[model samples]
Target: MRPLSTATLLCMSLIVPSLSQAEPRPANMVYLRTVDPTIEQDIRYATAHNFTGHPLDGYEAPQCLLSLDAAQALARVQASLKAQGYGLKVFDCYRPARAVADMGRFATQPGDPRKAEFYPRVDKQDFWHLGYVAKVSNHSRGNTVDLTLIGPQGLPADTWSPAASQADCAAPYGQRWHDGAVDMGTGFDCFDERAHTDSQAITATAQQNRERLTEALKKEGFVGYSKEWWHFTYAGDGAQKAVMDFPITAP
Candidate 1:
């Protein structure tokens, strides 16, 4: 319930310098680390470890960029969770429009090199149809984030183990993607019904973890995506901002 610090407020101001303008100014986007360096970030698109099996465009570096307001809100969420012996670990934030476009393109022309790991039951061409990929993502608006909770040990409960079998997202522990995130039924961007926020198929423990993440984020006005437990959006003015195409790089 604490208010954003003056420093965070000042940083937020820099994220959207032209609120009066009709179109959003991409340059106004600020790196999340600048607002709160203590938060952990693992921007997946900057590397080849994601579902794409390769680095997407417009992700020049591993960075978490967000609108000022969103960053400020997330910082608050992080503080609240930290007090509860949990913390936030971001996967993606403020995606560039070009990267979203790249995802769409990948959907059309792809073999499934990573299918066994990411979307084994789904076809590549069906990604758009299944709502696994969005033509226009909320992330491009700079207010959405894909994240998970770090436990009291300062890391996710599960860790990626290359030796683990590749199983459906809803599969039991050691059978699903080992992304080291707190067990939330499925891995981040699992593209499965099990990833749904309220899915009852997962174990009670996963459900509790998901709810814990939801409550922490909700405390700061971040809304969880019903389809993706790890995804959340700050429904602030930044939600209405124009989508951006800037690369995510260190500021």
Candidate 2:
């Protein structure tokens, strides 16, 4: 083979830097919509509707990206729920490691714009101690998700504005901000005991709804966190071991 000319080598150097700068998503990761377009996604961290009241780092878009295994399993769960006149609506999936750091910073910092609604009963500094926020999240492994169940009579989700009226996350289902999901005792990211998976403090209907969601996810190898009914981690094969930092980009 002939040695490359000076111009050819110079051009190659220029192209190499640009190519290396673009970080490609891991091959094992996939957007959940491609697996099941019917599964609704409301990626909270990509927007200001979450507890932080600001879009977190590394969330460039509101999309559900999960491990291929988890995505397929969730699709199967969705199919089962659809047959029963219910569906899965995911709030978050495949969170980047940077987002976890952002959450940690929020917990320690001095801002409470969303405190009235998301963590009214608890202090922000207590989020980590109470298990509401994790320094290292399983979601960064791409096999965990936060979601809710949507049933036939589910109300339309209200658009959240910074100026919207705030309600306690543990408020009665009808009184709290609706996310078009079935009543599961408390709203997503609620930092109260009532949000516990087996909390008996909630209404019987909410208890039943939690159980239904739990059973469905359990059947598909998802294990629910006792502290949050909406959180589940896929424990089946192909679950990612290493946490990822890939940005959640637009499709």
Candidate 3:
């Protein structure tokens, strides 16, 4: 057979691979090692509890960025804040497409044992009915994450606890985004309108803190999702990493 044209090859390259592999993503992708102490404290706190937690089996995976360049840049930003004693703790990075599938399947019955520990409050069957997942997710893009900040002592002083559905995004400051970190009215996974970065229903403190975090993230090349207070991205870069698969144990 004749060789494919360069344009055709490039177009084929756009096709994303499935996730849930031992090593995911291209080497050109950036990844910054976790160096911020405060970030460490925060993750330790979550690990201690089951909040927005990662199952123990997936622990060895390097918490990385799609591109190593992005990683180093983010690391520098975290380092600069070290003197103030706060740092970034990543909840997820470079998600495998297979893992995304896992989430979709789990979403269908969120209350399952694997689902229960991470989201005990959710009903399990309502995930599809909720906006939490579509056949395709931006998270598959590899720039999105589901994490929160930590206090000086570690542990989420106020983290967004999960609700069974996106409808739960409203109600109130359901979890807690206060205790030294910027307030964003709702916690990380609020899943509702009130959780919006610009929601009027939030407290003045929450709004102010949200703005502060937004500004800081912007300075470091990230942008907030607006609908979810805890969500943000480096902007203009996530589409390159989208893959389809379930995130789970791989041999």
Candidate with top TM-score is: 2
Model 3 misplaced regions, further than 4 Å: 1-25, 29-31, 34-38, 41-65, 79-86, 110-130, 150-182, 236-239, 242-251
Candidate 1 overall lDDT versus native: 0.79
Ranking by lDDT: 2, 1, 3
lDDT of 3 by residue, 1-251 (tens): 99999998888666754344335446455444433333432222223232223333333343544444445545655665564565565655555555556556655543343333333354546545655445665555655544444335433444434443232223344343333343446544544567667889878866765665566566767666765676666564433554633232212
* Clash totals for all candidate models: 1, 0, 27
Where's the lowest-lDDT run of ten residues in candidate 2? 15-24
Q: List the residue pairs that clash in candidate 2.
A: none
User: Distance from true position, residue 86, model 1, in Å?
Assistant: 0.3
Give the least accurate 10-residue stretch of model 1, judged by summed lDDT: 153-162
lDDT of 2 at 174: 91
> Which ten residues in a row are the worst by lDDT in model 3?
41-50
